[model samples]
Target: MAWYMNSVEDLAELYNRVKEKNIPIERVSDHGHAIGIYIHDPDGNGIELSYEMPASEWGHDPSGYMIGGTAKGRLSGPWDEALARQAQVTA
Candidate 1:
């Protein structure tokens, strides 16, 4: 449900094209260097299109990784133990 447009003008043009086809667009907004649009697909699921931040803002930085048991506050219950023991599987 996401897309990237290099510039605002391209985003606007695409919006107009869809409008010509009588589609329903809920809203559009600018998020700093990126822009996002919200709409409903024909089946009514929400959809989002976005232009991502410049590549400089993204890279391999392990500092952002969250320790499994530390998420959602201190792990104090059975669910926490299950999460901690989950196999190291990646999708």
Candidate 2:
């Protein structure tokens, strides 16, 4: 999915709420400190909600791509800046 969370605990709670409401989740995974959760919306598009830190040693990045973090060896893209910021603000 294009957007997601960065905290497993929060994602877990959300997942439970949706599931309790009769929503079905496609799958879930634990990528170290990150938890990847997926669900298919009514239109059949797979949406993913996850909790993973940015791929950077420092806390913030202006260029949107800072290296050196736990996700190093994992094949993944840089954290979406807008998505990350939204998560932070909402949290």
The candidate scoring highest on TM-score is 2
Clashes of 1: 0
Residue 69 of model 1 has an lDDT of 22
**What is candidate 1's lDDT per residue for 1-91, written digit by digit as tens?**
7767775566667666766787766665444335566778899988876554554443334776433322232212222232334323321
**CA lDDT of every candidate:** 0.53, 0.56
Q: How close is candidate 2 to the true structure, as a TM-score?
A: 0.52
Off by over 4 Å in 1: 53-91
- How far residue 9's Cα lies from its native spot in candidate 2, in Å, is 2.5
Distance from true position, residue 58, model 2, in Å? 13
| TM-score, every prediction | 0.51, 0.52
Over 1-91, each residue of candidate 2 has an lDDT whose tens digit, in order, gives 6346555456657666767787776555545446566778899998887767554533346767543333432423332333355457769
Instruction: Report how far off residue 45 is in candidate 2 (Å).
Output: 0.3
